[model samples]
Structures are given as structure tokens and as C-alpha cells.
Target: MKSLTAGAEIDAWCTKCRMDLMHRIVAMVQSAPKRVICLTCNSEHNYRAPRTETTASGVHVRARNTGPKPSPAAARVTQKARAEKERADSWSSKTLGQAVDAFTRYAMDKSFREGELVLHSKFGEGYVDKVLEGAKISIMFRDGARTLAHRAN
Candidate 1:
């Protein structure tokens, strides 16, 4: 087996190309390649060993796993739920003792300043977090912070 070192060319699974391609070692840890750049596509990613399986004929063949994996949509839903809970907690703490009538109704043509409270038809009550460039404003709602257009003048 050839020795491994930084800048050495080796066969690795390229995530971007989704194939075992020639890669140049960019980083090494404990004499093992930790990161590599694909020579085919010029994409940099963590090093993954090329998977091989022995057939009944005693020959090694490259194998790719085609099994069912965890759903990304389910993972996204879980993360969104956690983030929504956090945002709700923050909104509650900020809106404590504040009256509902104190919030100004949201209007695209109306101007708003940072630290002011506003009521939106779609997003409910929100606090103006920032006055952004080009008549845009970031508002923190119970769900999350959102950018909306407003009158800058």
C-alpha cells in the first residue's frame, strides 16, 4: 500500500459527484486523510472510504447502499417544532404585561421604527427588530423573525 500524506492522490467517494473518483488529500489526521478535493469536479468534502464487497467468485466489487433511509422531511419537521417552541418562549417573555391594543397595525405604506410593536394580519403581533435597507424591516413574531416591506420615508 502506498503511504498517505497531504497532497497525495487517492481514491475516495466524492459526495458531490456521488462516485469513487480521484481526490487530492487536503488535510490529514493521525496519518489518515480527513479532507480531500475531487480532481474530477473540483469540490471539497470530507473523505469517505470507497465501499467494496466480495462476491461469491472471490472478486471485490464496488457496492453502493440502496436501502431506505430516514426521511429528511421528518427531521425538518422536528427541527421546526423545536425552533417554534423557542420563538414562542422568547415572544412570551418579551410581550409580558403588554396590552394587545398597544401594537400598531401593520401596513406596507406606513413607516415603522425599531423596538416598536406592530400587528400583522398574517403573522399576528410582532416587535420591530430592525429597520433594514430598501424599506424592509425585520419583525420578531411568535413563530420567527420575518422581513417585510414598509415605508422608509
Candidate 2:
């Protein structure tokens, strides 16, 4: 590996020259490698090693944070929206046992074990921790904390 330093000449590919040309290191910025100014084309640009994170399957994995942060006012609106969505999505007035019953029946029909892994219609996704006596059961969800309910799937 070639170590780059200011004032040192390095062989860097020039977009204009279409070949590796000698370049002089000039300015460097934080979090990036040293800057390389092409001597032949007289152009300054930053150069970095081509890198990637690969999964166990050898597939490249890209991390992204696409969620937007909320400003104070925007946060209030978001909270209200979330509350409304919860109210809309909730099976209110219905007993949690009813949900468990429905989920268990579905799982049994599909040949899945009782209190197995499942997705919640509301609370995102989770796994059934265990089936308790009567209608109470425990569910471990992605949002953290275990939930005791009559049904979770």
C-alpha cells in the first residue's frame, strides 16, 4: 500500500488523461484521504480506497438512515400522527385473548408451533415468548420490552 503525504508525487488515475498519471498531494480534509492534484491535467480531487462491507453470503450491505428528524413543531405533528395511527390500527374493546386465539388457530392450521415467531399487525414485528395458562402470553418485540397479552402473532 502506498502511503500518501503532502508534497509527495503519487500515481493517480486522471479522468481527462484516462490513465494513471503522476499527481502531487496538496490539501487533505477530515475523514477523507489526502488530496491529489494531477500534474498532467492540473486538476485537484480527493481519492479514497474503493471499499465495501459484505454480508456472510458475500453480498454487499449498504447502511442508510433515511428517516427524517423532526423539529419541535414537526415533532408534535409526528406524535399526533402516531397517536392517530395507533388508535386506527388498534383492535380496541377487543380482548387480547381474542387476538391470541385468532393467532394460535392460524398457526395451528399452518403447522406452526404455538407461541412461535410471528409478526404483529400493529407493534411492528416480534416473536411469541410463551403461551401462558388461560389467555395471557408473553411477546418479545423489536421496540424492546416483553409484552404480556392474551394474544400476539
Best by TM-score: 1
Q: How many pairs of residues collide in model 2?
A: 1
lDDT by residue for model 1 (8-108), tens: 99999889988888999999998899999999999999998864411332342223434367789989999989988987887777665689888989999
Cα lDDT tens digits, model 2, 1-153, are 666567877666665665667877786565344677789889887753322212322442323433365679988998989976664444232223345534432222232334455555666444565566645555555444354555323
Off by over 4 Å in 2: 1-3, 29-32, 48-153
TM-score against truth, every candidate: 0.43, 0.27
lDDT of 1: 0.87
Whole-model Cα lDDT per candidate?
A: 0.87, 0.54
Best by lDDT: 1
State in Å the error of residue 21, model 1.
54
Please report how far candidate 2 places residue 109 from its true position, in Å. Answer: 37
